[model samples]
Target: MMTVFDRRSLLRTASISGRAALAAPGLLRAQALDEIRIDWATYNPVSMLLRDKGWLEQEFQGDGTRITWLQSAGSNKALEFLNASAIDFGWTAGSAALVARVNGNPVKAIHSFSRPEWTALVTRADTDIGTVADLKGKSVAVTRGTDPHVFLIRALADAGLTERDLTPVLL
Candidate 1:
């Protein structure tokens, strides 16, 4: 799926307790840093693709480098890891990148991932509710700062509705 990557803080947790500043395979190989720790957002396909596939480890296995993976529930958690220096790379959205920058996080974008929009709203099939227009004066649940919220905004705009039309339920 092609995904729009929103800006976000690097999801790397180099915490005192607990970080994919993600690099393409080519770049990763070229740098060959002493250690290769990739911080992936919670449980997602990218980590599965790399860890389950073993592609990243094998490439650096003989180069005296070790591969480590950090799992984060969300970009905010991932950014916590980055601040601690526990990881070298983090995975996050473009919106996250923007917020983190405003709050003072040092990071850079080195690659792009899915071009597809990864978030959407789903209602029960038998429900009378249908489109955003059906939501007038109703409540909508959304993740406050994430794409779910972004989707709600864009979707409402398409329906010629505004936040005034529906009460927001933040999750």
Candidate 2:
């Protein structure tokens, strides 16, 4: 017989596995966890669903653990929260997470819930910015330390340009 797992079940399984991995070392020390802070980002629908369903709360109720749900406005915010130890788990873009890890944040990626194609370079229809090169002297609004920023940087590099060639308005 074959069994199919829905989105909820998949998220639950991943969450449980991640939690187990994190708690294993602490388990040897007999550490008691009183609270778990996790962030939900708008870009991650699955996280929103998990938060709305209160699955973490239900799972830890027997252990008297409190599940605190936090909102991450962007990958940059998520990384900040992780660095500050404000949250135990957070949803962030792979690139953003990698950047944090490279910067010695001691973060780990437990699960990849989705491969998103959400980043884009857009310009006003009235503007003459037709290509990456056209953005050389333009002002680009970007959230630093996020996936979009990485994408923009790569795009600029590909065009033989850099942020120095453009005005990057940090959002």
Question: Which candidate gets the maximum TM-score versus the true structure?
Answer: 2
Q: Compared to the true structure, candidate 1 yields what TM-score?
A: 0.67
Q: Which pairs of residues have clashing backbones in candidate 2?
A: none
Off by over 4 Å in 2: 1-8, 26-32, 157-160
- Model 2 reaches what TM-score against the true structure? 0.79
- Output the lDDT of residue 159, model 2: 96
How many steric clashes does model 2 contain? Answer: 0
Per-model TM values vs. the true structure:
0.67, 0.79
Model 2, span 45-153: residue lDDT tens: 7678778877777777887778898898988788889889999888888878888888888887767655555678998899999999999888999977777898899
What lDDT tens digits, residue by residue, belong to model 1 across residues 25-127?
Answer: 4344455567777786644555555566565666666766777988878766666687788777777766666677777887665555545546767777987
Strongest candidate by lDDT: 2
